[model samples]
Target chain A: MTTAATTHHSAVLEHRDRFRPRQAAGKGHVSVRNVDIVFDTHHGPHTAVQGAQLEIQPGEFVCLLGPSGCGKSTLMNVVAGFVKPRHGELLVDGQPVAGPGPDRGMVFQQHSLFPWKTVKDNVAFGPLMAGVGPREAESVSRTFLSLVGLSGYADAYPSTLSGGMQQRVGIARALANYPSVLLMDEPFGALDAQTRTMMQENLLEIWSEFRNTVLFVTHDIDEAIFLSDRIVVMSASPGRIIADIRVKLERPRQAELLTSPAFMALKRECLALIREQTLHAFEQQNRKH
Target chain B: MSVKPGPFQASSAVVPSSTGERGVIQADGAATETVVGTDAVGAAVEASHARLPANWRRYLVRIAALVVAVMIWHLAAVNDLNLYLRFENVPNPVVVGTEFIAQLSSQTFYLHILHSMERIAIAYGLAVVIGIALGVMMGRSRFAEDIILPYIEILRPIPAVAWIPLAILMMPTEQASIVFITFLGALFPIVLNTVHGVEQTPKVLVRAARSLGASNAAILRHVVLPGALPSIVAGLAIGMGVAWFSLLAGEIISGQYGIGYFTWSAYTLVEYPKIIIGMLVIGGLGSLCTLLVRKGCAPLLRWQKEAGRS
Candidate 1:
């Protein structure tokens, strides 16, 4: 495919694949009941997510897991206060979902590091915006950079660093805000296999220590099985939750768990559900044809 | 299709520096090549010969070119190459050089230089302030762009000297009119370029700043301006050139003292060498201004150097 055509296809597929709302988020609490996401594309109303309902407790690492084209990201946005659901109430901290605030930190798939900013400056940006003094904000940023194993890279520009290094800066930037909950949209989806594995382990290590309530979206069932305390599986087309598996694995889940029979078995089960969703999607496409 | 004897691995790589040395001496006069191995990141040395930093070498070349030009002038003047031209008007290079030196030491030339410099200083100051303000404003919002771009484009096509009549009508004095005209010349290029630079700042850069929780003002200062720095410096250099052009034009039309005024005065008296001197002085001053601005921007844009190394 031509590059422009491919990009256009990806963008269209992105909108068809994930739900993005046009309006600001509202609130009562961060709860979604029968939420539906529909977009008016050139092909008419493209239903991204339909009837997705989930309850996330405070300090829970919940993974919204599904196959490609599933609107798992749609559900994450609903909770992050970026999307206003068509037919549901979303809440955070016992209040309805308002527009994005410092209370919820978001780490994107791409690091999106400011090329002009040094690592410390990029990390300290939120605190600086919130009127924190430079010296204090800097100290906090340094601590977070150290946590991410990028302490020496504090003065480095994102452009100078590798993709993995840049993403560490992104994580540090979000964590420096000390948000109650962290929302990640496939933060390691762009990394190579080795880097992605390293990042996943780093993320789990972070979760074990801070235990920040996380709503992560990913297509990798293995990753969901590895990182999540519970996995929320959704189906595509007009998206809906096919399964919600509670992972009752013990605390301090290490990378070693990934090789265990138990983790593999869980991954197999999740893969079965995603495969079923893919089959259903094909059948649906055939029906339309 | 090969494994061990793959084309890339088997090819003998000619190192760029040696090739470049040959290229500099050859008729092509370009940097021939620079060897780049995969992931062989190296420290940045100075600019290549082709990308050589403008230095005394360039000025010396300019001087050599000037000497050649002078010799030609002397030849043509003495030999009467232009058979159709009148004899009384043409002067030899030596006569011009002697006259130029005498003028340089005299108060008459210095007064003109002072006058031109004063006009440039004032107009350039105003141009920078207005251009930066307009540029930043135009850059920030699409609405401002829609309103400003059409007007800038329309006025840009109209030469700064074309506004002289209008300036004369509006302003009471000749000095005011000349300064106004000069300001018009400097202003358009500065604003146009500044606006272009600021608007062309990468959207990704702005988005990165936004995600970092930066205020709009902070984004403008830290991201937008720095991102646009190279272009802005380019614009400043171009603006100085335009300012110099305007200064000469203004003096030509209305000035008691200045290089342009002196050149025009010499032309009326048929003094060809003094006119040449005025042109050279203008060229020198313009080059100096550009060099100063370039030096100022170099440290702030160290990434440009890093980019070269990589």
Candidate 2:
């Protein structure tokens, strides 16, 4: 059974490599150039994000870290092509983002999976939509489901699965399309602490294997630090890139790294910057009131 | 884990452990089950074991209530009880019972039932198709809504009874008029509810579909349709009820063979007992049709129940 499983795994790996040849140097390059997003509200035109300039290399994991209403998510959505920036452009692999496509996979904060579909079907949806044959889509779903440790729940509906499990399926679903860039809008924000930690670990494991460019958005400083190679901190509101801090911590990180000296130092640096911005934002709000 | 010999115990063992892991992942599944397990399971076990007796008791209670009602009716009719209302001309329970039994074996009685059923089936089926199509279009596109909504809003409030004269004039035959009234009765509720369902489909799901490389047409077919289904099913059930209501109204005025016509004709001939029988048959058939709608839609909505429970 072990030998058979190993061979099957290897064959799937070979098939995947052939299907999407990984550019060893540059493939999933994301560039956000002076991107500004504004929402027309009842009051007036509100700036959600401003002058958001950043570049993510192929296979790099970057987190847009900010407080609530900081428009970190909006910036990420621009890359996902769900939101059109008022100014500047988003480019993925040298092509301008016109609209959402299979090349850029996204995981929302919660309840994004098609509830009517079984877990296997949900994971297979991208492949099916991309015009993959039914049998091949089913096989791809199986492979991704197993990758997320949800092989037993292939037939179960998304509603039947736990939140963590649903998010795992979400990840699997996103990855099944072999997207060049994975955009996550605080996917683990809804999970409990323990589950969130486990999910982070699981995501890292998957990232190590696939090496897709990931642009994750989150409010949690620790989560951003733990998950990404670099953390792009944003101002509280009318969000702009305030700081770009590289996580020098070694990869294959464990839960214990949360308390390490280097980790704490980085966290302190992030905390000070975030505190100043949050205070400034509060004072601005007070003046408006 | 300790080995359990009994099937129940073994099953319980598996459920708790597997669901415990699931709980950690989400906390809604295992936590509730484990906390309430002993009491809930015991109650369930007792209910299952004594289901036969319990069912019998329920039937007996229903029978008793109905018997009491019938006894009152019998007493009132026999006594010729009159205050503000008159029972002097009313047939007693025994007379109606006898008439019902007689009608049960009659070929004409079956024909009346078959006619009503056939009309309802045709009208309701048409309502389901046209209502859903129009509803989806209206919900998805502002242009469609702008063009179609005025007609829907104006027609929706007008009761089916009011449409009888216009329908009779509009349709060529009595059967066509009656079916048209029934179709009109069913259409509005279905179309309105379907519109609501389509509009209520989550924005995130659409975005997810888009991100997954689904085209606009694919999103509609796969995401919007399924998302709107639960509400559509609800609309269908309500529409089935309204269809029966209008069918009876139409049949009383225009149908030659339906139960409504049978009841009205009985009133004209002073066959009071048969009138009661016809009324009862109509009630029974309406309930049955609604039950069929719910049962037919249950498989499509299985996920909703599971999600609600969790």
Candidate 3:
């Protein structure tokens, strides 16, 4: 299925290849070893994630599926080097996760594009910071902008773009550095149902060509089912990987296949696991209150 | 640019080069042009038409208000009206107008205007430089804030006028003293406003820039400075007004040649008409200077105007 999709989408592959980041140092192999994250609150120390362990192979599409406050985002942040684990080691491409770097491209939930910059500059930012010359950076931006189908909005500011377009620009900005891994924190969570569905499919199309590792954090089981090659369901509060389910769905999964028997079977299993975890979490919160 | 940033913007996210969604792209293209063309043209026309008559009306009302004020002043002065309120022997509009026209032709009048303008230009320029630097430093660093804030708080309340005696004693010359006073007046507003602006910058923006691999210096340049600009400009506008206030006080007290000096000398000589002319000139120049400051700052703040969020 993957091979067929590759042949079928060779045109897209050409465009994606032309615009891929200069240093295609594709080394997105993430290793999380006994990761524990704690936050200081007024009440006391609160464990967000405890003894979390996972291994993500380079070029693999994976989703950390869980209920909100389950520390999925915290774990992702640890990989992105925004949050340091209180205890344990996080390695990306055998390098220690030290601080936020261009090596891991991040697409935030709110499409945190710099509002002051034009769309082109926003995409150019990663390359520019990595010491790319101004003209080269601009060319890099133009290529990626074209790849994201936002070639026309090069001069337009981010505030003027729609939410989805802004997120697309965000993706373009992140990918401009040719990062080994893309950390998306519910990139389409704010979109309407149709747009979210469309975004998921569009994302898969981009992913197919680039084949960069993706650690997509989301609570939506359908999104996980549709996008990921592997679904890692996290348990509620003090998040840990409870179940690591491999998705057997074929590549270039379409919206129509969302209702297929195999797809529904996988969705049903994820739904039950999430429902059970969510219910347990709710009860725990009720007792605390 | 014709793209409508609507919810369906996601549909455009579909690769047109890809085999699927060609019909959706064509449909979106035609619909977008129609919507953009009508919306842009209609909004432009409506905005211009709405602004034109209102602007004309404002100018006319302003002219009428000035005329009425002059008329009331003329009547009161000519009739020696309000004698009980001690408004007697005040210069009438005609006398002041005549004197103003006569003064405009005199070399001394031009010299006075030039001297006042030169003092303000030098002092205000210096104030802007120092104020912005200090403000940004204070806003960016806790150490700078702690060190500078106490002195600022102590000095801000002490009016520029109150600084006159100390300024005269400390400076080498009277001109230096007057310029120092004017600089002091403009400094506070510019610094305070800049600090406020910088501090008010969104934390998310800083984080976003950081995550994008920008260093601290880059974040300050790309994020904090632009974010803080609108407030800094507002501070500069206010600073110009306060600078003029101090400029007048400085000129009146110890000026060798300025509008304020002319007005003070007129009072001493009992040349009431000349005093009134000086007052009018001073008011005109003060407002003109502030208008210039606002205009100068406008280009730097184009992002705010273009946002059209309001």
Per-model C-alpha lDDT, please?
0.68, 0.81, 0.78
> Candidate 1, residue B238: CA error in Å?
2.5
Candidate 2 structure quality by residue, lDDT tens digits, B52-132: 765887778888999999899999999999977899989998888888888889999999999999999999999999999
Per-residue CA lDDT of candidate 3, range B1-310, in tens?
Answer: 1112243444533211111111110111111112121122234345556578767877788889999998988888888897576558698888888888998899999999999999999999999999999999999999999999998988888888899889989999989999999999889878887888788777756766777788988888888988777667667767777888888899999978999999999999899899888888888998788768767866775544444431
User: What RMSD, rounded to one decimal, does every model reach?
Assistant: 11.8, 8.2, 9.8
TM-score of 3: 0.85
C-alpha positional error of residue A1 in candidate 1 after TM-score superposition, expressed in Å? 50
| RMSD (Cα, Å) of model 3 | 9.8
Question: Candidate 3, what DockQ?
Answer: 0.27
Task: For each candidate, report its DockQ versus the true two-chain complex.
Answer: 0.11, 0.28, 0.27
Query: Residue B4: error of model 1 in Å?
Result: 37
Question: What lDDT tens digits, residue by residue, belong to model 2 across residues A1-289?
Answer: 3553454356446646645555333579999999999999999999999888999999999999888898999898899999999999889999999999989999999889888889999998988987878888898888888777777789987777767788888998998888889999999998878778878877886776678899999999999999999999888567888778888889878778988999999899878877776677668768988
Every candidate's TM-score, chain A alone: 0.83, 0.91, 0.88
Candidate 2, which CAPRI tier?
Answer: acceptable
Candidate 1 chain B superposition, TM-score: 0.77
Worst 10 residues of 1 chain B by lDDT: B21-30
Local lDDT at B281 for model 2: 90
**Global local distance difference test of model 3:** 0.78
Name the runs in model 2 displaced over 4 angstroms: A1-25, A272-289, B1-56
